[model samples]
Target: MAYVVFVGGLVVVLAGLTWFASWAKRRGRGSGVAGALAAYEEAYRTTAHQSHHELRQQADRKSESGSPDDL
Candidate 1:
């Protein structure tokens, strides 16, 4: 009885996945490199923006502490 239930559950899960794949295909969600490139570009932009912001903040602190000529 337990084996039967397990097999039945697996069948249901697989059927659900099959249906989802079919739906995605119908919606033209085919897998391609564009999605990966977009993700990579977004990550690169975020990292660059964060580094620029930190550098600006550090420079501000240094200026506030007096210019290099004052040292």
Candidate 2:
């Protein structure tokens, strides 16, 4: 039960981090975000490729069912 709450909190935090990164860039965070994004991209490099294909396959199943904030 506590683990589930922790995971949910983590998701929300990551979402906020994503939004903050985008906002920071707009306000000129520069290399600050570049490095972070590079690390982030590397972290998910393999999963991203697979997830890309999976998302494509699921595209027809639920047009409005998933979150588009997958960046």
Candidate 3:
């Protein structure tokens, strides 16, 4: 049980690190230890991708159209 707990903790830590890296990448934070990963993610997002920016733009347009549900 103790071993299992230790492994679980390690996995959780690693997953958190990955999530932080991804979050940093999306925010375009490319000037620290994770710069390379951030740049790679940015490139991927810009090439044949449909996330973040696209969805935000769509939502903005919808709001501009004055949709009642959005208000």
Q: Whose lDDT is higher: candidate 2's or candidate 3's? A: 2
Write down the lDDT that model 1 would get. 0.73
Local distance difference test, candidate 2: 0.74
Candidate of highest TM-score: 3
Alpha-carbon TM-score of each model against the true structure = 0.43, 0.40, 0.44
Local distance difference test values of all predictions, in order: 0.73, 0.74, 0.70
lDDT of 3 by residue, 1-71 (tens): 99999999999999999999899889977456544544666787654234545654686784437668887
Give every collision pair in model 3: none
Candidate number achieving the greatest lDDT relative to the actual structure: 2
Candidate 1, 1-71: lDDT as tens digits: 99999999999999999998889889867455445654665577777556656665796785446668987
Tens digits of per-residue lDDT for model 2 on 9-62? 999999999999889879876666555655675577967656655664796575
Cα miss at 40, model 2 (Å)? 16
Best to worst by lDDT, what's the order?
2, 1, 3
